[model samples]
Target: MLDFTKSSAPAFQNLTPAQFAEGRQQPGAVLLDVRRPDEFAAGHLPGAFNLDVTASDFGPRVAALDKTRPTYVYCRSGARSASAAGQLATAGFAQVANLLGGVLDWPGALTTK
Candidate 1:
């Protein structure tokens, strides 16, 4: 769970499953599944880009994305994507959001493609 009272709260948004689902439908949404490739292959959010947060090229890969766009990230759970969201915020991303509870909380939102 995210502490909305924290100073970092303004740095990015921590969205609940419902909010995540709604927000992701907006135009120019950039959803990133920050999980390992194998995990991503099993299932992931439709249209999400799989980028392992633990990989050596993670920074460079994310760097190529448009920082001004609204970026939403998640993992199996919320942990790893929280780290990735922090990195994105620090990298000057104008709009960053993390999917609270991640994909585990959205059983109906995943697709195995």
Candidate 2:
């Protein structure tokens, strides 16, 4: 059991691409994209919800997500979402993780459909 409370928040899980893909398919997992509006509109994983961490209401917006579920966070290049993941932890989310390199390292294609 990982003591997420005692362990450092925002610590990279550094998942393999395959593991990431699998995680995405799991039930009760949320994909959180913390990129800016423009960047998110450009490209992002299918089904990932945009929360735009830079927005003033980021904390409240993220609070709407299911805290009991695991949240997989990403940004354009892995920076912003790492911070968001930490914030999620502090806000009482138990299972949260940051995509190691964000969407920049994702090998899959993006779609707006």
Candidate 3:
């Protein structure tokens, strides 16, 4: 259950690639990639789930996630993920993290599937 009547909204953190990697290893953490299917198929972080930000079901898909759990989001250039993070916060998500500069600034190894 989420308390949407709070006076203050939860602020999503802008984490660097290293910070984002470390945080994603935490228990109950969800790695969400907000890029298109084709972009995701090319390459993406290991274990990340695709939820295209441009899709019609984006809001509904995000709403289905556990709002209390920590969610890590990323996009091609960080723009879409940033927007997604804001949406999540507005939807009463308690914890949200955005990957600064998105995958473009990621210094970690990526996987293609």
Candidate 4:
């Protein structure tokens, strides 16, 4: 098992969809979808960007992200995002958060485009 408490960033902090909605309104905030490209194409949050953790380049992909900003990550349930969040933390991302229930509990306010 992973020792999230030892990390520089918090682990498993739950963020509601509304919180994610608000984050999108803030400067330097990014919503990161850790789902696969196909799942993302099927449906995702309006402004969320897809970066699959299963890919071999996941680390480099996240490394390309702005480490100075907060990133909101989510997956199908909560598993993948947790992993991705940990990676981000290890990669020196300052602030990171994860959606509690993924898109399964997004409350229908989410839209895909």
Candidate 4 structure quality by residue, lDDT tens digits, 1-113:
97876755545356787886676567888889999998898888878899999999999888888998888899888788988888888888888888878888787545557
TM-score for each predicted model, relative to the true structure: 0.89, 0.84, 0.89, 0.83
Cα TM-score of candidate 2: 0.84
Which candidate, 3 or 4, would have the higher TM-score against the true structure? 3
lDDT (tens digit, per residue) of candidate 2 on 9-75: 4343545556777876779889888988888888889998899999999988878878888788889
User: Positional deviation of 52 in candidate 1, in angstroms?
Assistant: 0.4
Give the TM-score comparing model 4 with the true structure, all chains together: 0.83
- Report the alpha-carbon TM-score of model 1 versus the true structure: 0.89
Candidates 2 and 3 compared by TM-score, better number: 3
lDDT of 2: 0.81
Best by lDDT: 3
Model 3 lowest lDDT segment of ten: 2-11
lDDT by residue (tens digit), candidate 3, 3-99: 8778575589999988999999999999999999999999999999999989999999888999999999999989999999988999999999999
- What candidate 3 gets wrong by more than 4 Å, as runs, is 1-10
The true-versus-predicted C-alpha distance at residue 46 of model 1, in Å, is 0.9
Q: Model 4, poorest ten-residue lDDT window? A: 5-14
Off by over 4 Å in 1: 1-10
**Candidate 4: lDDT of 45?**
83
User: What is the clash count for each candidate, in the order shown?
Assistant: 0, 0, 0, 0
Alpha-carbon error at 24 in model 1, in Å? 0.9
Which residue pairs collide, candidate 4?
none
